[model samples]
Target: MPELIGIARLAAESPSLLGKKRVEYMSLTTRSYLTRCNNPRMPFRWMINPYRGCEFGCKYCYARYTHEFMELRDADAFEKKIFVKSFGPRRFLGELRKLPVGESIAIGTATDPYQPAEALYGVTRAMWEQFARTAGFRIGLVTKSNLVTRDAGVIASASRRHAVTIVVTITTLARDLAGALEPLAPRPELRLRAIRTLARAGIRVSVNLAPVLPLINDSEASLDAVAKAAAEAGAVSLGANVVYLKDCAKSIFFPFLEAQFPALAGRYQERFRNNAFLRGAYPEMIRERVGRIRRKYGLDSSREAAEPELWPRDPQLTLFS
Candidate 1:
């Protein structure tokens, strides 16, 4: 028999958690719910992903590589085969308690914490439910779902205890285009509603106009529309990043373009064939463009430096910097 060592072993033996006709939810036993991000460039000190696969299935998702660790190589598997990590309340809190106070922890780094499964599994819900009891930590959550609005009260309470920021990613304001790009995510209008609701509840919220695809949605007008809506909806900050395509994402994205954006596929294939990050003028221009938009709306950068005294006991940290 072939050796199924480490994570692959656990992945193979995981029990079924839930089943949809087109999707399968598996229960993955986990030793630690929190992980340290050693990369110096990462803004947060720690990361947590409640679920392994995201059903939103955005055509340009860069997180596709995460599923490879489970030995699932097919691109579609990231969306179809979901893994819900087993959660033990006390244990989850225990691991959390061990971390020093005031350290930053980013949620949903690899996948959506509030993915559709979260409605059923409630792992993300449990996280905030427990976090409300804690004091003095920096928490940031990134998601593409408006389902987070359901826990607005709990999140607001937790915000009172610790520094909490919720970032709702809306790549475009055009509903049809958003549907085409992020097929399964909530509509752009719903996401904007979530932002307004969260902001009204006194929770700090931001907008991420990320993975700004070249020649697709990167136009000034396209980005400006998202920013204007985000600001009008009560977002205090906004951030945008150019698309970074790795082999894993390319395998899926390239084919998606051929089918949906055939005219642009060839250019994208050539541009990103060698490098993952599109550096130089295009990215710099985006930086300038996003900067202009941020100023125009009186908004802050999502990774803008935190006030040094937000947590006086520790050194200041930049979120997603």
Candidate 2:
């Protein structure tokens, strides 16, 4: 077994030193795997996750439960123990072909497809290429990294055949807050630039100001600023939702909240004590605020129709019936 060393020692002798020393790290490896989530609320039935865990280390990540399923005990280790699916694109394409041709597919539903490691793995690029040949299907990609810019050409080609929407998620405009919340993801301005690039190429681009944590990012001015930026970036639509902590997410999110915005932590604890989902009132307020901002900026709402019922069903077989 490899022994753990303190960050100070590593920084003193290693060439990778930067700023101050903190946080011990580890590494691991794995093979191909797939996660099938039965999402009733989302607009798609199936999700293609090319990577197992995320490097972004977003404090409010809901996918932490996935680590438990893998029998991984440490939360910090989850972010670093990223598993790449070498043959994921081939297997995923094969599975996609087995289903109806027009079935909607959502990518990165469980983890960010363009996470930093993607620059090294290139699995997501292959998946996009495979889907580029198909027609009449709907594909939605949600991510925070600007790396998607590298595949703008492929995405544009795919859009010519089927529906393609790219949603770039940005929570807070403040650089410091963003750094604290999403340590490993691309900065907000870079993601905004990517949005502009994709929109310029005529690919539908939207902004998802999702999981808007109370006290941390629930201010009216903050919401409006994000909407304005989205509109300026030529986004076709804008959506916003309040944060809701579930299971392992609480462990990771609360500490940050306590350290950064101590005044708001008590309110969050009281409001989300028993419920995993945010209170009905919170969503209503968020919807109203987001709707007002959308109208103000002349941006469309990003909400879409419910997932097709016969999602895993064949459309051709029913065509003649």
Candidate 3:
């Protein structure tokens, strides 16, 4: 593992080289990195994860499963111990040149790129520089942190050249609720500020009211408030979706729910029982409510309607195969 001292040196000297070829020694350094993903359900054919293990520590983070794959345990360590991928920029650019051009690229697919660690690592900015140097590709960023504002210049430039959409994921405007659910993420207001900053800079900005916890953040009033906020902030698009708890996320999320909203915990259990995906009328109900709010706010329903599925599945790829 790279030691903290070496990581700092690398970050200071060359922060963008996160791909495999540039990585010589694995270090426990606080460096910036990226990963490539080919999940069919994802809208982009490729993805870049600048860091491993999220500091946001949202109880319902599906990326928690990634920690186990990295041979790490102890959920508490998720926030403190972050792995920075070395030589990320070089690797990313190299791969970018080799791959078919003009494909959509998604950042922050697994872990947020603008998390607090970014203030120090500077990997996300480095990655943006690399993307800016290249052309013929669409770039998308999904983050819950307002820190993205720090790079508004680069984001705005990227928008001018290619398709770049910034999706700010804010589940609820309630600070208390946000704190309880996403213990380490930035407050909703700060994320809203980021939206405003990016929008003012002419960058395409959107709001993703994701993981709308059932009986928690799923209220009609809550969704409307979010839509209103997004529109007022100059977001060109808005979207909402029910929370899906998978793997260890269930373990971490349910307990938090039981403690925070005791009265409605049973309702969630009953609703999600035997259903991996939250189904039935709840999704439609929320979607309809969100649509009505968007129309009322004079926001384009087209962005919401045209939102691409995260991934397009291949029928030929069977589960077993």
Number of the top-ranking candidate, with lDDT as the measure? 1
Lowest lDDT sum, 10 consecutive residues, model 3, at: 303-312
Candidate 1, 224-309: lDDT as tens digits: 99999999999999978899999999998999899989999999999999999997999999999999989999989855324323
lDDT of 3 by residue, 19-54 (tens): 333122123433323345666766776677877667
lDDT measured at residue 52 in model 1 versus the true structure, 0 to 100: 92
Residue-wise C-alpha lDDT for candidate 2, range 1-321, written one tens digit per residue: 344344323322333211213322222222323334576777786677777678888999988877665556576655866655555456655665665556567888778999876787677888778777555567788999999999999998877766788989999888888999999889999989999999999888889998788767878899888888888988878877677788688888778778888888888777778887876787888889888988999988853423333332446642110
Instruction: Pick the winner on lDDT between candidates 1 and 3.
Output: 1
TM-score of each: 0.94, 0.83, 0.81
Give each model's whole-structure lDDT.
0.88, 0.74, 0.71
Q: Distance (Å) between predicted and true CA of 247, model 2?
A: 1.8
Each prediction's RMSD over C-alphas, in Å, is 3.5, 7.2, 8.8
